[model samples]
Target chain A: MSTPFLKKDKTGICLKLHTALYGHDAIEQFRGAYGDGLTFVRRGAYWILSFADALEEDVVDSLDSLLVLSRNRKK
Target chain B: MKKFIKADGWVKVPVQTKAYPLQAIYSAGYVFMDKAYLYLDLEAKDKVVVWLKPKAKADLDKLAMEFCQELLNYAHYFSSLKVNAESTKLLLQRALFSAAPSMVKEAEEKEIQDLIKELEQEEEKENRKPVKKGKK
Candidate 1:
């Protein structure tokens, strides 16, 4: 389930989320939940969550939940 | 012995999941925190690819070997803990039992008395110090 924001590169697949929409805390939460399979890096105002090839599907599912949680917290 | 591929300034080490689980990889990475920047990737199903980049001017080969050794150490530690889990649980229960409210109160009372005695001894030692006579 790849979204427009999620794409595959030479290294692996990455999901890019805006820091404004998710905030910095989301990175830590995602990393804690996914462990080594998930690596996060901040590029300008966006946080990119890169997942290993083997973990692409799991990362996508986790990302969906993270976005849902972020939306709920906003309300 | 596991083989690691060296390229440029980074070492790509492959770890078998059956021998060293993800936890062991994490532990090994933590142990090498000061020496190198460790990255773990599960590109394959049963293997973890560990990329170790030296943080300082050091021997990459030696660091890679040390990282492998650390993984084995953690694997052994984890396996031993699993084997002794029941004994550990029992020990913890006994420890908690021994640390009941009554036992804690008694220990606190003893500690307070010891602290008071030490303070009094310090005061006495200060009192016995020779006083400097002020010039008239």
Candidate 2:
């Protein structure tokens, strides 16, 4: 019922992002985890993952971790 | 595609005949109401006044149906409901969230948890009933 990804404005801007995991490989990995119902979009700084089913909690956690890892790679 | 200018000064983007992105169009509406804070504004402003046209209601409805159908296809695969309750839940969530996250609305994680509970209940009901055995 709920969306696979939730959009938020970390910065107060007129934008509602459907951000998922980051990086090309990370996004692909996430799609593989939840079956073939997802479509990953690469937009600027984030990856948008669309799933027909509400993604499982574990999937979200894994994605969050992946993003953290991606962010850390820059440093 | 003719770039028509609206009376209220918004340059209306042409709806492309060749495979328009459904998400982008619908996302615009979400960004307007949720991110732009238009709906939350205290001013008694109306979209009708701006000439965006009330006719877009039909287009919006059609887009919603398309989105739901796509959602239903995916939902049927994992859903436990005999009548496809998971698809119905997806429709409900879209209406509530408008495809955007807001602090005022309940988190999507919580919504997913609630839906899982409903699915479990449905599964329980199915298990309670007995299957008839055939005579040899």
Candidate 3:
């Protein structure tokens, strides 16, 4: 049998499954299957992110703008 | 029966490279998505192919993420200069095994074990089949 997905090396950013807004339940279900590594949160509209560390301050700010731009484009 | 000669059929070619490291990030992402939905081709080399047959949602998702990273990495690496086909191939293999080395290794190990188990099960089943009786 294949070895279950376990934390390999606790170094780099932990793999996170990010999804669109409507994908919350799907992300949550995945969290249940994979463990607590998954997180649901809001970005521009909404996003699911998992990472070893929060992005750099500038990156966060840029992402925020990008999210807003994306939201605007949708409408 | 009549003897006949057969000719080889045409087949789509596959490309094997990590990603070109000089394209727009968003456009690169789209290329990855397209390839995932279709096939990965090596346009430089007789178009050799490489792809993963996702067995589960998790597997598919992970592969998508890896593709994203490869595109990002490729763009980052080559934005300043031109990359040859040889270097491109190496970069892609690195991307493949680098994204989730542990996961890929685990999967390969599991696949080997599963194959062994399957062979054993087939052997057991063969031993259990009833033999046909000849006419009395």
DockQ (C-alpha based) per candidate is 0.02, 0.01, 0.02
Off by over 4 Å in 2: A1-21, A55-59, A64-75, B1-136
What is the C-alpha local distance difference test score of candidate 1?
Answer: 0.69
Over B3-121, each residue of candidate 1 has an lDDT whose tens digit, in order, gives 56876667888888988976777667666766675545454667767767676888777888888889999999999999999999988866975878686677789999999999999
DockQ of structure 1: 0.02
Cα displacement (Å) at residue B1, model 2:
56
TM-score of chain B of 1: 0.68
Using lDDT as the measure, name the better of candidate 1 and candidate 3. Answer: 1
lDDT of 1 by residue, A1-75 (tens): 333234776557887765544556755676786776667778876677778765544543454456434434432
Query: lDDT, candidate 2, residue A22?
Result: 29
Ten contiguous residues with the weakest lDDT in model 3 chain B: B2-11
Location of the lowest summed lDDT over 10 successive residues in candidate 1 chain B: B36-45
Q: Best by lDDT, which number?
A: 1
- Clashing residue pairs in candidate 2 are none
